[model samples]
Target: MAKFKLFKDRKGKADQAKNNKFVKLGREIYVQARKGGPNPDANFGLKTAIHNARQINMPVDNIERAIKKASGNGENVEYDEIYYEGYGPGGVAIMVKCLTDNRNRTAADVRSIFNKRGGNMGESGCVAYMFDQKGILIIDREKFADLDEDILMMQSIESGADDIVTNEDSFEVLTHPHEFESVKSAMEAAKFEFSSSEVSWIPQNMVGVEGENAEKLLKMMDAFEDNDDVQDVYTNFEISDEEMARLG
Candidate 1:
Protein backbone atom coordinates (compact mmCIF):
# COMPACT_ATOMS: atom_id res chain seq x y z
CA MET A 1 0.00 0.00 0.00
CA ALA A 2 1.15 3.52 -0.71
CA LYS A 3 1.99 5.68 2.27
CA PHE A 4 -0.95 8.03 2.69
CA LYS A 5 0.32 11.59 2.77
CA LEU A 6 -1.31 13.67 5.48
CA PHE A 7 -2.54 16.60 3.43
CA LYS A 8 -5.74 17.24 5.34
CA ASP A 9 -4.07 18.97 8.28
CA ARG A 10 -2.08 21.37 6.14
CA LYS A 11 -3.88 21.64 2.79
CA GLY A 12 -7.34 21.65 4.31
CA LYS A 13 -6.60 24.81 6.31
CA ALA A 14 -5.06 26.53 3.30
CA ASP A 15 -7.82 25.40 0.99
CA GLN A 16 -10.65 26.65 3.15
CA ALA A 17 -8.93 29.78 4.46
CA LYS A 18 -10.27 32.19 1.86
CA ASN A 19 -13.86 32.50 3.09
CA ASN A 20 -15.02 30.45 0.09
CA LYS A 21 -16.07 27.47 2.19
CA PHE A 22 -19.46 28.94 2.96
CA VAL A 23 -20.24 29.38 -0.72
CA LYS A 24 -19.07 25.86 -1.43
CA LEU A 25 -21.14 24.58 1.48
CA GLY A 26 -24.20 26.42 0.17
CA ARG A 27 -23.74 24.91 -3.26
CA GLU A 28 -23.34 21.42 -1.83
CA ILE A 29 -26.44 21.89 0.33
CA TYR A 30 -28.45 23.08 -2.64
CA VAL A 31 -27.46 20.11 -4.75
CA GLN A 32 -27.85 17.54 -2.04
CA ALA A 33 -31.26 18.92 -1.11
CA ARG A 34 -32.34 18.97 -4.72
CA LYS A 35 -31.30 15.35 -5.08
CA GLY A 36 -32.92 14.06 -1.92
CA GLY A 37 -35.02 16.72 -0.08
CA PRO A 38 -34.44 19.66 2.24
CA ASN A 39 -34.57 17.56 5.41
CA PRO A 40 -31.12 16.62 6.65
CA ASP A 41 -32.74 13.92 8.73
CA ALA A 42 -33.69 12.13 5.54
CA ASN A 43 -30.58 12.95 3.48
CA PHE A 44 -27.28 11.50 4.64
CA GLY A 45 -25.19 13.59 2.25
CA LEU A 46 -26.93 16.78 3.29
CA LYS A 47 -26.49 15.89 6.92
CA THR A 48 -22.79 15.26 6.38
CA ALA A 49 -22.39 18.58 4.56
CA ILE A 50 -24.20 20.36 7.37
CA HIS A 51 -21.98 18.63 9.90
CA ASN A 52 -18.89 19.70 7.99
CA ALA A 53 -20.03 23.31 7.83
CA ARG A 54 -20.69 23.38 11.55
CA GLN A 55 -17.26 21.88 12.25
CA ILE A 56 -15.71 24.77 10.33
CA ASN A 57 -17.62 27.33 12.42
CA MET A 58 -19.93 28.38 9.64
CA PRO A 59 -22.71 30.64 10.91
CA VAL A 60 -25.97 28.94 11.86
CA ASP A 61 -27.93 31.61 10.03
CA ASN A 62 -26.01 30.95 6.85
CA ILE A 63 -26.66 27.25 7.11
CA GLU A 64 -30.37 27.78 7.73
CA ARG A 65 -30.56 30.24 4.86
CA ALA A 66 -28.94 27.71 2.53
CA ILE A 67 -31.44 25.05 3.52
CA LYS A 68 -34.35 27.44 3.13
CA LYS A 69 -33.20 28.62 -0.26
CA ALA A 70 -32.76 25.05 -1.34
CA SER A 71 -36.26 24.06 -0.22
CA GLY A 72 -38.26 27.19 -0.83
CA ASN A 73 -39.01 29.31 -3.88
CA GLY A 74 -35.67 30.91 -4.66
CA GLU A 75 -33.41 31.41 -7.60
CA ASN A 76 -32.91 27.76 -8.32
CA VAL A 77 -29.34 27.29 -9.39
CA GLU A 78 -29.44 24.02 -11.28
CA TYR A 79 -25.98 22.59 -10.80
CA ASP A 80 -24.68 19.56 -12.58
CA GLU A 81 -22.02 17.45 -10.93
CA ILE A 82 -18.99 16.77 -13.10
CA TYR A 83 -15.51 15.35 -12.67
CA TYR A 84 -12.43 16.31 -14.65
CA GLU A 85 -9.34 14.15 -14.66
CA GLY A 86 -5.86 15.24 -15.65
CA TYR A 87 -2.14 14.93 -15.09
CA GLY A 88 -0.35 17.65 -13.21
CA PRO A 89 3.36 18.40 -13.00
CA GLY A 90 5.55 15.35 -12.30
CA GLY A 91 3.00 13.02 -13.85
CA VAL A 92 0.73 13.42 -10.84
CA ALA A 93 -2.82 12.38 -11.55
CA ILE A 94 -5.42 14.95 -10.60
CA MET A 95 -9.16 14.72 -10.25
CA VAL A 96 -11.33 17.79 -10.09
CA LYS A 97 -14.92 17.49 -8.88
CA CYS A 98 -17.24 20.32 -9.78
CA LEU A 99 -20.82 21.43 -9.38
CA THR A 100 -21.71 23.91 -12.05
CA ASP A 101 -24.81 25.38 -13.62
CA ASN A 102 -22.85 26.31 -16.71
CA ARG A 103 -20.60 23.59 -18.08
CA ASN A 104 -19.01 25.81 -20.70
CA ARG A 105 -17.90 28.37 -18.17
CA THR A 106 -16.57 25.77 -15.79
CA ALA A 107 -14.73 23.88 -18.50
CA ALA A 108 -13.08 27.01 -19.84
CA ASP A 109 -11.97 28.08 -16.41
CA VAL A 110 -10.52 24.68 -15.53
CA ARG A 111 -8.88 24.26 -18.91
CA SER A 112 -7.22 27.64 -18.68
CA ILE A 113 -5.75 26.83 -15.29
CA PHE A 114 -4.38 23.49 -16.46
CA ASN A 115 -2.95 24.96 -19.60
CA LYS A 116 -1.18 27.70 -17.76
CA ARG A 117 0.10 25.35 -15.08
CA GLY A 118 1.82 22.76 -17.31
CA GLY A 119 -1.08 20.34 -16.99
CA ASN A 120 -3.79 19.18 -19.35
CA MET A 121 -7.32 18.01 -18.83
CA GLY A 122 -7.86 14.35 -19.68
CA GLU A 123 -10.75 12.42 -21.12
CA SER A 124 -13.35 10.81 -18.92
CA GLY A 125 -11.97 7.84 -16.97
CA CYS A 126 -8.49 8.64 -18.12
CA VAL A 127 -7.06 9.43 -14.70
CA ALA A 128 -9.93 8.15 -12.58
CA TYR A 129 -8.63 4.62 -13.09
CA MET A 130 -5.67 5.57 -10.88
CA PHE A 131 -7.92 6.31 -7.92
CA ASP A 132 -10.52 4.58 -5.82
CA GLN A 133 -13.62 5.86 -4.10
CA LYS A 134 -13.43 5.27 -0.36
CA GLY A 135 -15.12 6.42 2.79
CA ILE A 136 -12.63 8.40 4.89
CA LEU A 137 -13.23 9.16 8.56
CA ILE A 138 -10.88 11.54 10.36
CA ILE A 139 -10.90 11.79 14.15
CA ASP A 140 -8.96 14.13 16.41
CA ARG A 141 -6.10 12.23 18.04
CA GLU A 142 -6.15 14.15 21.31
CA LYS A 143 -9.64 12.94 22.19
CA PHE A 144 -8.94 9.27 21.59
CA ALA A 145 -5.68 8.62 23.45
CA ASP A 146 -7.44 6.02 25.61
CA LEU A 147 -8.63 4.12 22.56
CA ASP A 148 -6.13 1.41 21.79
CA GLU A 149 -5.03 1.00 18.19
CA ASP A 150 -5.70 -2.74 18.35
CA ILE A 151 -9.26 -2.14 19.51
CA LEU A 152 -9.88 0.50 16.86
CA MET A 153 -8.44 -1.76 14.19
CA MET A 154 -10.71 -4.61 15.21
CA GLN A 155 -13.74 -2.37 15.24
CA SER A 156 -12.91 -0.99 11.83
CA ILE A 157 -12.33 -4.44 10.40
CA GLU A 158 -15.61 -5.69 11.80
CA SER A 159 -17.31 -2.69 10.26
CA GLY A 160 -15.86 -3.64 6.84
CA ALA A 161 -13.14 -1.04 6.84
CA ASP A 162 -10.36 -1.50 4.31
CA ASP A 163 -7.62 0.23 6.26
CA ILE A 164 -6.77 2.29 9.35
CA VAL A 165 -4.01 4.84 9.55
CA THR A 166 -2.91 6.75 12.64
CA ASN A 167 -0.96 9.90 11.99
CA GLU A 168 0.71 12.22 14.46
CA ASP A 169 -2.55 14.00 15.30
CA SER A 170 -5.36 12.07 13.67
CA PHE A 171 -6.82 8.66 12.93
CA GLU A 172 -7.92 7.95 9.36
CA VAL A 173 -10.34 5.11 8.90
CA LEU A 174 -10.89 3.93 5.37
CA THR A 175 -13.85 1.80 4.36
CA HIS A 176 -15.88 0.76 1.40
CA PRO A 177 -18.43 3.31 0.28
CA HIS A 178 -21.34 1.18 1.49
CA GLU A 179 -19.93 0.75 5.00
CA PHE A 180 -19.10 4.41 5.54
CA GLU A 181 -22.13 5.38 7.56
CA SER A 182 -21.99 2.29 9.76
CA VAL A 183 -18.32 2.81 10.63
CA LYS A 184 -18.90 6.50 11.21
CA SER A 185 -21.75 5.69 13.60
CA ALA A 186 -19.60 3.14 15.40
CA MET A 187 -16.84 5.68 15.99
CA GLU A 188 -19.32 8.33 17.10
CA ALA A 189 -20.98 5.91 19.52
CA ALA A 190 -17.55 5.24 20.96
CA LYS A 191 -17.34 9.01 21.67
CA PHE A 192 -14.59 9.79 19.27
CA GLU A 193 -14.27 13.43 18.26
CA PHE A 194 -14.28 13.30 14.47
CA SER A 195 -13.09 16.37 12.63
CA SER A 196 -14.69 15.27 9.37
CA SER A 197 -15.90 12.14 7.64
CA GLU A 198 -16.87 11.64 4.02
CA VAL A 199 -16.41 9.55 0.90
CA SER A 200 -13.54 10.85 -1.26
CA TRP A 201 -11.29 9.82 -4.08
CA ILE A 202 -8.04 8.32 -2.85
CA PRO A 203 -5.10 8.07 -5.17
CA GLN A 204 -3.62 4.63 -5.55
CA ASN A 205 -0.08 5.98 -5.98
CA MET A 206 1.68 9.27 -5.53
CA VAL A 207 4.19 11.24 -7.54
CA GLY A 208 6.86 13.04 -5.57
CA VAL A 209 7.34 16.67 -6.57
CA GLU A 210 9.80 19.04 -4.98
CA GLY A 211 11.18 22.56 -5.15
CA GLU A 212 9.71 24.95 -7.73
CA ASN A 213 7.62 22.35 -9.56
CA ALA A 214 5.98 21.34 -6.33
CA GLU A 215 5.28 24.95 -5.54
CA LYS A 216 3.69 25.50 -8.95
CA LEU A 217 1.49 22.42 -8.60
CA LEU A 218 0.31 23.56 -5.20
CA LYS A 219 -0.55 26.98 -6.60
CA MET A 220 -2.49 25.38 -9.44
CA MET A 221 -4.49 23.31 -7.02
CA ASP A 222 -5.16 26.40 -4.92
CA ALA A 223 -6.49 28.25 -7.93
CA PHE A 224 -8.76 25.40 -8.84
CA GLU A 225 -10.06 25.15 -5.30
CA ASP A 226 -10.78 28.87 -5.24
CA ASN A 227 -13.16 28.52 -8.17
CA ASP A 228 -16.79 28.59 -7.03
CA ASP A 229 -17.77 25.84 -9.45
CA VAL A 230 -15.18 23.45 -8.08
CA GLN A 231 -16.33 21.22 -5.23
CA ASP A 232 -13.22 19.17 -4.53
CA VAL A 233 -9.80 18.54 -6.03
CA TYR A 234 -7.81 15.34 -5.50
CA THR A 235 -4.23 14.85 -6.57
CA ASN A 236 -1.41 12.35 -6.26
CA PHE A 237 1.35 14.86 -5.60
CA GLU A 238 3.25 14.21 -2.39
CA ILE A 239 4.96 17.12 -0.67
CA SER A 240 7.55 16.57 2.05
CA ASP A 241 7.19 18.01 5.55
CA GLU A 242 9.89 20.54 4.74
CA GLU A 243 7.89 21.83 1.78
CA MET A 244 4.67 21.97 3.79
CA ALA A 245 6.34 23.95 6.58
CA ARG A 246 7.68 26.45 4.07
CA LEU A 247 4.28 26.76 2.39
CA GLY A 248 2.54 27.13 5.73
Candidate 2:
Protein backbone atom coordinates (compact mmCIF):
# COMPACT_ATOMS: atom_id res chain seq x y z
CA MET A 1 0.00 0.00 0.00
CA ALA A 2 2.84 2.28 -0.81
CA LYS A 3 4.38 3.70 -3.95
CA PHE A 4 4.99 0.90 -6.42
CA LYS A 5 8.74 0.62 -6.37
CA LEU A 6 10.40 -1.87 -8.68
CA PHE A 7 11.74 -4.84 -6.73
CA LYS A 8 15.41 -4.10 -7.47
CA ASP A 9 15.18 -0.77 -5.63
CA ARG A 10 14.12 -2.23 -2.27
CA LYS A 11 17.44 -3.40 -0.80
CA GLY A 12 17.64 -0.67 1.84
CA LYS A 13 14.16 -1.31 3.17
CA ALA A 14 14.03 -5.04 2.44
CA ASP A 15 14.36 -6.14 6.05
CA GLN A 16 11.49 -4.02 7.29
CA ALA A 17 9.42 -4.91 4.30
CA LYS A 18 10.03 -8.59 4.94
CA ASN A 19 9.00 -8.26 8.58
CA ASN A 20 5.77 -6.54 7.59
CA LYS A 21 5.12 -9.22 5.03
CA PHE A 22 5.53 -11.90 7.70
CA VAL A 23 2.90 -10.30 9.90
CA LYS A 24 0.42 -10.02 7.05
CA LEU A 25 1.06 -13.58 5.94
CA GLY A 26 0.73 -14.87 9.47
CA ARG A 27 -2.63 -13.22 9.92
CA GLU A 28 -3.88 -14.71 6.69
CA ILE A 29 -2.61 -18.15 7.64
CA TYR A 30 -4.18 -17.90 11.04
CA VAL A 31 -7.54 -16.89 9.63
CA GLN A 32 -7.51 -19.69 7.09
CA ALA A 33 -6.33 -22.28 9.58
CA ARG A 34 -9.00 -21.35 12.10
CA LYS A 35 -11.86 -21.17 9.64
CA GLY A 36 -11.15 -24.27 7.64
CA GLY A 37 -8.76 -26.46 9.65
CA PRO A 38 -5.09 -26.43 10.63
CA ASN A 39 -4.17 -29.24 8.25
CA PRO A 40 -3.11 -27.77 4.94
CA ASP A 41 -4.01 -30.87 2.96
CA ALA A 42 -7.56 -30.75 4.19
CA ASN A 43 -8.02 -26.98 3.95
CA PHE A 44 -7.53 -25.35 0.59
CA GLY A 45 -7.40 -21.84 2.05
CA LEU A 46 -4.75 -22.88 4.60
CA LYS A 47 -2.75 -24.57 1.88
CA THR A 48 -2.87 -21.45 -0.27
CA ALA A 49 -1.94 -19.21 2.66
CA ILE A 50 1.02 -21.45 3.48
CA HIS A 51 2.07 -21.41 -0.16
CA ASN A 52 1.93 -17.62 -0.20
CA ALA A 53 3.93 -17.32 3.02
CA ARG A 54 6.58 -19.68 1.66
CA GLN A 55 6.83 -17.59 -1.50
CA ILE A 56 7.91 -14.62 0.65
CA ASN A 57 10.51 -16.78 2.44
CA MET A 58 8.66 -16.78 5.76
CA PRO A 59 10.43 -19.11 8.20
CA VAL A 60 9.02 -22.62 8.62
CA ASP A 61 8.91 -22.15 12.39
CA ASN A 62 6.93 -18.93 12.04
CA ILE A 63 4.53 -20.54 9.62
CA GLU A 64 3.99 -23.56 11.88
CA ARG A 65 3.47 -21.33 14.91
CA ALA A 66 0.70 -19.44 13.13
CA ILE A 67 -1.06 -22.72 12.43
CA LYS A 68 -0.53 -23.95 15.96
CA LYS A 69 -2.00 -20.80 17.43
CA ALA A 70 -4.97 -21.12 15.13
CA SER A 71 -5.46 -24.75 16.01
CA GLY A 72 -5.35 -23.96 19.69
CA ASN A 73 -7.80 -21.08 20.22
CA GLY A 74 -7.85 -18.98 17.07
CA GLU A 75 -11.38 -20.08 16.29
CA ASN A 76 -12.57 -17.79 19.02
CA VAL A 77 -11.09 -14.81 17.22
CA GLU A 78 -13.92 -12.98 15.51
CA TYR A 79 -12.33 -11.25 12.58
CA ASP A 80 -14.49 -9.67 9.92
CA GLU A 81 -13.50 -9.02 6.34
CA ILE A 82 -14.29 -5.43 5.41
CA TYR A 83 -13.81 -3.50 2.22
CA TYR A 84 -13.35 0.25 2.32
CA GLU A 85 -13.63 2.26 -0.85
CA GLY A 86 -12.30 5.73 -1.42
CA TYR A 87 -11.01 8.25 -3.92
CA GLY A 88 -7.48 9.48 -3.44
CA PRO A 89 -6.04 12.77 -4.55
CA GLY A 90 -6.56 13.25 -8.30
CA GLY A 91 -9.63 10.99 -8.04
CA VAL A 92 -7.63 7.76 -8.07
CA ALA A 93 -9.88 4.85 -7.25
CA ILE A 94 -8.80 2.98 -4.14
CA MET A 95 -9.87 -0.14 -2.33
CA VAL A 96 -8.68 -1.12 1.11
CA LYS A 97 -9.32 -4.72 2.11
CA CYS A 98 -9.13 -5.42 5.80
CA LEU A 99 -9.55 -8.25 8.27
CA THR A 100 -10.17 -6.99 11.77
CA ASP A 101 -11.72 -8.24 14.95
CA ASN A 102 -12.83 -4.69 15.66
CA ARG A 103 -14.79 -3.19 12.79
CA ASN A 104 -15.52 0.14 14.44
CA ARG A 105 -11.85 0.74 15.20
CA THR A 106 -10.71 -0.19 11.69
CA ALA A 107 -13.38 1.96 10.10
CA ALA A 108 -12.44 4.92 12.25
CA ASP A 109 -8.75 4.47 11.48
CA VAL A 110 -9.33 4.07 7.76
CA ARG A 111 -11.68 7.05 7.63
CA SER A 112 -9.21 9.20 9.51
CA ILE A 113 -6.40 8.26 7.17
CA PHE A 114 -8.50 9.07 4.16
CA ASN A 115 -9.56 12.39 5.61
CA LYS A 116 -6.04 13.37 6.62
CA ARG A 117 -4.75 12.50 3.17
CA GLY A 118 -7.37 14.65 1.43
CA GLY A 119 -9.46 11.73 0.34
CA ASN A 120 -13.03 10.73 1.11
CA MET A 121 -14.14 7.27 2.15
CA GLY A 122 -17.13 5.90 0.29
CA GLU A 123 -19.59 3.04 0.35
CA SER A 124 -18.32 -0.48 -0.32
CA GLY A 125 -19.03 -0.70 -4.04
CA CYS A 126 -17.80 2.81 -4.89
CA VAL A 127 -14.51 1.90 -6.57
CA ALA A 128 -14.57 -1.86 -7.02
CA TYR A 129 -16.10 -1.58 -10.47
CA MET A 130 -12.89 -0.18 -11.89
CA PHE A 131 -10.77 -3.21 -11.05
CA ASP A 132 -10.67 -6.83 -12.10
CA GLN A 133 -9.45 -9.77 -10.05
CA LYS A 134 -6.67 -11.63 -11.83
CA GLY A 135 -3.87 -14.03 -11.02
CA ILE A 136 -0.32 -12.81 -11.55
CA LEU A 137 2.92 -14.78 -11.64
CA ILE A 138 6.17 -12.91 -11.89
CA ILE A 139 9.68 -14.26 -12.61
CA ASP A 140 12.99 -12.44 -12.63
CA ARG A 141 14.00 -11.89 -16.22
CA GLU A 142 17.72 -11.84 -15.52
CA LYS A 143 17.59 -15.24 -13.85
CA PHE A 144 15.99 -16.94 -16.81
CA ALA A 145 17.79 -15.23 -19.67
CA ASP A 146 19.22 -18.46 -20.99
CA LEU A 147 15.83 -20.13 -21.39
CA ASP A 148 13.98 -20.24 -24.69
CA GLU A 149 11.26 -17.64 -24.48
CA ASP A 150 9.13 -19.21 -27.18
CA ILE A 151 9.13 -22.62 -25.49
CA LEU A 152 8.60 -21.13 -22.08
CA MET A 153 5.73 -19.03 -23.36
CA MET A 154 4.26 -22.02 -25.14
CA GLN A 155 4.55 -24.23 -22.11
CA SER A 156 3.02 -21.59 -19.90
CA ILE A 157 0.10 -21.24 -22.24
CA GLU A 158 -0.33 -24.99 -22.46
CA SER A 159 -0.39 -25.06 -18.70
CA GLY A 160 -3.45 -22.75 -18.61
CA ALA A 161 -1.91 -19.30 -18.36
CA ASP A 162 -3.88 -16.60 -20.12
CA ASP A 163 -0.79 -14.80 -21.37
CA ILE A 164 2.91 -14.29 -20.72
CA VAL A 165 4.85 -11.09 -21.27
CA THR A 166 8.43 -10.07 -20.81
CA ASN A 167 9.40 -6.69 -19.45
CA GLU A 168 12.89 -5.38 -18.77
CA ASP A 169 13.03 -6.72 -15.23
CA SER A 170 10.58 -9.61 -15.13
CA PHE A 171 8.50 -12.11 -17.02
CA GLU A 172 4.82 -11.93 -16.02
CA VAL A 173 2.23 -14.60 -16.48
CA LEU A 174 -1.47 -13.75 -16.33
CA THR A 175 -4.15 -16.26 -15.57
CA HIS A 176 -7.76 -16.56 -14.50
CA PRO A 177 -8.22 -16.87 -10.74
CA HIS A 178 -9.18 -20.52 -10.82
CA GLU A 179 -6.24 -21.53 -13.01
CA PHE A 180 -3.61 -19.83 -10.84
CA GLU A 181 -2.51 -22.79 -8.76
CA SER A 182 -2.44 -25.17 -11.67
CA VAL A 183 -0.29 -22.80 -13.71
CA LYS A 184 2.03 -22.23 -10.79
CA SER A 185 2.36 -25.96 -10.23
CA ALA A 186 3.10 -26.54 -13.90
CA MET A 187 5.72 -23.84 -13.90
CA GLU A 188 7.32 -25.37 -10.81
CA ALA A 189 7.33 -28.80 -12.46
CA ALA A 190 9.06 -27.25 -15.44
CA LYS A 191 11.76 -25.78 -13.17
CA PHE A 192 10.68 -22.19 -13.54
CA GLU A 193 11.16 -20.07 -10.45
CA PHE A 194 8.74 -17.32 -9.61
CA SER A 195 9.50 -14.07 -7.88
CA SER A 196 5.83 -13.66 -6.89
CA SER A 197 2.43 -15.21 -7.34
CA GLU A 198 -0.80 -13.66 -6.19
CA VAL A 199 -4.41 -13.06 -7.01
CA SER A 200 -4.77 -9.28 -7.24
CA TRP A 201 -7.30 -6.68 -8.20
CA ILE A 202 -5.71 -4.90 -11.14
CA PRO A 203 -6.96 -1.54 -12.32
CA GLN A 204 -8.52 -1.39 -15.74
CA ASN A 205 -6.95 1.98 -16.45
CA MET A 206 -4.48 4.10 -14.58
CA VAL A 207 -5.17 7.64 -13.37
CA GLY A 208 -2.15 9.95 -13.19
CA VAL A 209 -1.25 11.80 -10.00
CA GLU A 210 1.54 14.28 -9.42
CA GLY A 211 2.95 16.76 -6.96
CA GLU A 212 0.64 17.18 -3.95
CA ASN A 213 -1.74 14.49 -5.11
CA ALA A 214 0.92 11.82 -5.33
CA GLU A 215 2.34 12.71 -1.95
CA LYS A 216 -1.03 12.56 -0.24
CA LEU A 217 -1.88 9.24 -1.93
CA LEU A 218 1.36 7.60 -0.85
CA LYS A 219 0.95 8.84 2.70
CA MET A 220 -2.56 7.44 2.86
CA MET A 221 -1.31 4.09 1.56
CA ASP A 222 1.50 3.99 4.11
CA ALA A 223 -1.01 4.59 6.85
CA PHE A 224 -3.13 1.68 5.63
CA GLU A 225 -0.16 -0.68 5.40
CA ASP A 226 0.91 0.28 8.91
CA ASN A 227 -2.38 -0.98 10.29
CA ASP A 228 -2.20 -4.67 11.18
CA ASP A 229 -5.78 -5.28 10.09
CA VAL A 230 -5.39 -3.86 6.62
CA GLN A 231 -4.55 -6.82 4.42
CA ASP A 232 -4.28 -5.38 0.92
CA VAL A 233 -4.60 -2.02 -0.77
CA TYR A 234 -5.31 -1.36 -4.44
CA THR A 235 -5.27 1.87 -6.38
CA ASN A 236 -5.55 3.00 -9.96
CA PHE A 237 -3.03 5.79 -9.75
CA GLU A 238 0.22 6.18 -11.70
CA ILE A 239 2.88 8.67 -10.69
CA SER A 240 5.41 10.19 -13.04
CA ASP A 241 9.15 9.64 -12.50
CA GLU A 242 9.63 13.33 -11.86
CA GLU A 243 6.94 13.31 -9.20
CA MET A 244 8.41 10.18 -7.60
CA ALA A 245 11.82 11.86 -7.55
CA ARG A 246 10.38 14.83 -5.74
CA LEU A 247 8.65 12.47 -3.30
CA GLY A 248 11.92 10.65 -2.65
Measured by TM-score, the strongest candidate is 1
Off by over 4 Å in 2: 1-14, 73-75
| Candidate 2 residue-wise lDDT, 44-79, digit = tens | 678778887887789999899888888884445757
List TM-score per model, in order.
0.89, 0.88
Query: Taking the candidates one at a time, how many backbone clashes does each contain?
Result: 0, 0
Error of 2 at 128 (Å): 0.8
Model 2: per-residue Cα lDDT at residue 208: 83
Model 1 ranges with Cα > 4 A deviation: 1-18, 244-248
Pairs in steric clash, model 2: none
Local accuracy by lDDT, each model: 0.80, 0.81
